[model samples]
Target: MSDNYSIARYLISQLRPGLQLGETVLSPDGKVLLYAGTILTEKHIEKLSYYNCEGVRVRELQSGVGMGFDSNQQRKRGNAEPEELIVSHEYYEADMAATVSEQETEFAGIYGNVVKDLKRCFTIVRLEKHLDCELLQSIVDALLTLSERGIGATALLHTATRSEDYLFHHSVNVGILANIIGNLSGAFKPSQQRNLILAGILHDIGKLEIPVHVLYKKGSLDEDELHMVRQHPAIAFKFFRRFKEIPESVRLGVLQHHERDDGSGYPLQTAGAKNHPIAKVLGIADVYDAMTSKKVYGEEVSPFAALDTIQADSFSGKFSPKYSTPFLHELCQTLIGRYVTLNDGSTGQLVFWNRSGKETCLIRFSDGQVIDIMNQNKLKVIKLVC
Candidate 1:
């Protein structure tokens, strides 16, 4: 075995009955193979005897003794090829390690200077216009790297502080999500992707102008407070006008993200064709992060659930029809083949998309069993595991 082999690789051999440490298990050709982890109990020996395993031998590693099996007997029993077994172990280990590393990095990035920088942005709306160009570029670069690695930007949306820190995290997450949407939709060239990122980063700049109390309120807002909230887009637009170098697409996204396709939204209340494509994409990404985020008043919804809400609301004319359908479809497709932990504590991969229905499709086990959740009346998806 290679010195670098992971622990998972060492545990891949099939078990047989009566296997004992230090005893030689022989093949039909009298070759030795397979190792046992420890001395076999009578029950274990009986189980392997039923499988007709010849005998067990033990080999000790740095950690402990491993039981060995008869090679010829294993071949007859249809054991997986050694190469295939090793590859499977390696793949599993790599995936688990990457996930752990990502989680660590996300938590670390949430502290100290990074948090201070984000908090500063939240406290001053004008900072959006004056934001260090290099820093904005660095954030965009990091997002693109994450996309290439198939890591969800949502993983970076950490809420270490219960205050208005979510606003800062939300802003960053929206930026990353918007950039991803733009890239996936083919709405921009490589050169334009950064601009979309910037548009996403600044889309909610006007919210900084809202009183911190209103922004972080634990209670429901009254009608007058709600009206004040509606003026953010106009405030954002005014702020953007001061920066001549900012792209028009970015400026438009900041001003028009609040406007609905059906003219039900606020600020300018533009209808139909008036909303820009980048703005529409930004609006979708922004709402998704907000709805799925945990707050004082409510727990976060799953991403899949948020997607469903967006689709339902869009079909009801809450958003522009021109962009909503394609956007939702792409979002659903992006999530296919991903694993999610259901509320019932079962983990399964998302195998299908039910575009027309409320419940999505899932494949629950390794046996390829199909569960059409849309028709499964007793069960519902309660969470989306990253």
Candidate 2:
């Protein structure tokens, strides 16, 4: 309720070198402990840990481009002729704030840059015999940097409104998610993890050979079109064979990503023993990207809904329980602290997840009330909030 704060807020983690404090730091009881414009020092940040503070409010950070204090709050900074003060307030991440416009601007910056890089890489692989794996790694590195800062896949999914360049978008999305799954798999070697990411990048490369009309069709494909569509894995597999420099994991992953444990998958219909492990990772991430991304015919499903469909298939032996289950568990870990909109028209931060059951999640509302959503039978997390 105090006008003494900036609407743009930050977590304690954002307290890095060159971060200037924009407002007076206050105790929970409103007692001023630090003055306005006190540039945060290591000691000051270290003090926060002692207090067990979850986060701190600050003005825009004087850091980098697209980074800083909120310009809107700068109007209220000091003594002025008008002295207009803001009453009700909403606190949000300084980097990603309480404003829709601010979040959109940030997300657009990420989307445009990554999509451009992917387009270039896709073109390189299509036109040449050699693939620049480093360029692809650079894309994953950029996305990983954002994820390290807590602006991960869920945030991107929330910000994206449409799929303008669908292929590139899908490649980058699946790459980011595949790495997340691979890291948590506990069995994938570091090289295997890197290969998993590569697999995601090239998994759908064969689609390029398909006619644009069939590839981007807004309606169900005819039998002929469907048969052509399912040939993507084989197409990519054969194309990559020209480049002996490519990893076997990547080549086979490209070939087998659609292959299911139950043998109902496409191209080769390879299953179980024949399925490359990295392809299993690719399979899950691919389904997630497809479900949550805007398609020509249907709207994107929520992350939870996508998982529901995959898990159902997993139950029917479509995906290996040993593989798909862990992927789901680890992937869901990323959602623990994210905000979600519920079916009952309420919004909350996911505070806890019950390991024994998937449906029950503990969520904390804006008022700080934590509720186990499983008991609220009619309530389900309908979508993730940006």
Candidate 3:
């Protein structure tokens, strides 16, 4: 591991299930293999052994630490100040040498609940050809509701770690994102909005047909595996094509989301106005979420970087400007004043967005120095930080 990593080292045997990763673990080639805050599972441990890695790094304990909220104490205190509950790198780094504390256990328990509920919902989808709309809606509503309570979308997404069962978690994210975009664009009626959410939920229904060993593999995929994965959209389209209950917009979303404007995507080389508008939005949402979320192999880019890539794709004729322009503009507005982890491992505030520039942004560091990130081609914003 690099010396700049923000984590405490623990022996391989010392790491047990339920421990959260303090920072992202990288491959020998520097790609992010696992994201920070991901909960440990047996599969993860096995993979660690497969790579012959040494000890692992876990999140620093926060007992009696400043800026690290003591949830139990806060509950007894009635109402705590904003500063009292906020978690910060200063406090965590200061207490890195401290022993594992009880607060993380409680935090993990809360996250575990979200994961379990999500698993239940996905299992229902697998058994039935269609999702239990009410159950699925309830879970997504809870997530959105939490976001409304000032937790933000990333916080709610974090509750369901990216370490296990990515397909289901991804479906839930895309569903939430699709609903947000649809509602914000004022492009759909209330009924239309609900259907759009359902479409996002079932967009990857074909992936379930893929084998478990292949679906959850750790390393790079072989050509045959890649070919199988690419067939998912067509498989999904076939599955629900004759189901009268499924909406046309939804069926179109599942079938055409992977299609590109320039006729570059798989299954069908769909181009221009041929792709459905809803699918275009789904494609953007899908890419945005996947880029930000932890992955099985590739490195996760920061929100701004993801948007930049999407913007480049739009300019390259891979995505429609009709859908990508408004959506990216709206999303970028939400990112102003947010903190992000830089490629050089420094944390900075996103001060501005360059709408006309080749580079994406200008960021302000803690030391009162501002850097235009676009000038450095190799730099990447790792993730958005609260």
Candidate 4:
């Protein structure tokens, strides 16, 4: 087989039976569903759809005589010529819009289930004052599985609305975000990554111990109440200490997730190397989720704004650059190709993003005008429409 084929991305909804995969498709758990160069069939398409795969990379052949798929067969099957099979911009946009909607709906269902399970587990632990490691681990495992669904899962984080069950939603979002950061950092093994996610999930579990009135108060907290809220990490640490299933690093991470590199954060005021490695990653996730999530106190911040904050913090010594660099890099890739509504009341597709030097984006408008948003300070992304 010739290695000369190019690869193109296509939404699962746009996939046809005669197309050949340019890359292997894997399940959330890393199980291979199909191999590269495999000629797709009705069964293959059905299987891919069954997995809720967002999209696939298909081979664009010079002449589909190699890779076990013949162009002639595709034509005989009443499919379009291989050269004309490329997904058009309009087609991609239409298909992706549908895909994103379906993904968000599916994600909402999964998220609701996990949050319910987490709330139940929290209730059990709070009443019994006992840590059910297995139960909590099961919830965490479900979250990890959801987080492994690729970029769509990440985008789903923003789709979630702030509800009265803020704690549960926040915890789940942080866990998924932490897992993404860990994977992007390339600094953690699989075991360490799991621990990082576990830490994120349980980081705010201590808040459950705080008085409801104090925790949910809409107004500014008094000094005493603020101090009481700050102690949740320590409180959560004490809870995790009873369980041997929770790794020592996870305990530290939960305990010091608020700790900053500059020693400005709560409870311990641990600085730089004094903070556990996992704690640093958790801190970024925690802050990002808090800022991006809609709040009763304030409107949700745009993700581009959140990224800007992370970038600024990375340079300010509050967030470690090691993890923030890769997190921003990977996250920017996901945000690209998304449609956004600008502050100037214009809607366009984000065609280019350059986070280096200066944070800027190139948006291609419907009138085919490309605008560099950085040149127009008043122009900024206000919302992700799809």
Global lDDT of each model?
0.57, 0.65, 0.63, 0.74
Better of 3 and 4 by lDDT: 4
**Superior by lDDT: candidate 2 or candidate 3:** 2
lDDT of 2 by residue, 1-386 (tens): 22223345667876763244444454665433443333354666776666666666554422322122221322211232332212112432321243234334565687678779988987887677456767877876676643332213444554563577788878877776677666666667765656766677788989888988999988789999999999999998998877776688899888998999999998888888899888888898899888888766667777888878888999998887766787676556556555667765556566455556465666655433556666665557777764
Worst 10 residues of 3 by lDDT: 65-74
lDDT string, candidate 4, 1-386, tens digits: 22334567889998876465666577886655664444566767898999999999875645543222222221121132544322234533542443333435666888888888888888888899877678778877888778876444666677675556888888889888888888888888987767877888889999989999888888889999999999999999988877888899999999999999999898999999999989999999998888888766556778888888988888889999998898888677566546677765556666567777776676655433556677665567887755
Model 2 scores what on Cα lDDT? 0.65
lDDT ranking from best candidate downward: 4, 2, 3, 1
Give TM per candidate.
0.64, 0.68, 0.64, 0.74
TM-score between model 2 and native: 0.68
Q: Please give the RMSD to the true structure for each candidate, in Å.
A: 14.8, 11.3, 16.4, 10.9
lDDT tens digits by residue: candidate 1, 279-375: 8877888888887776665577777788778887787787654555666665564455444555544554454555664644643322223455555
In terms of lDDT, the poorest run of 10 residues in model 2 is 68-77
Model 2, runs deviating above 4 Å: 1-111, 124-162, 344-346, 355-358, 363-373
* Candidate closest to the true structure, highest TM-score: 4
RMSD of candidate 1 to the true fold?
14.8
The TM-score measured for candidate 3 stands at 0.64
The parts of candidate 4 lying over 4 Å away from their true place are: 1-96, 101-106, 150-152
* Winner by TM-score between candidate 4 and candidate 3: 4
Candidate order by decreasing TM-score:
4, 2, 3, 1
| Regions of candidate 3 where Cα sits further than 4 Å from its true position | 1-88, 91-118, 125-134, 137-161, 241-243, 357-360, 375-380
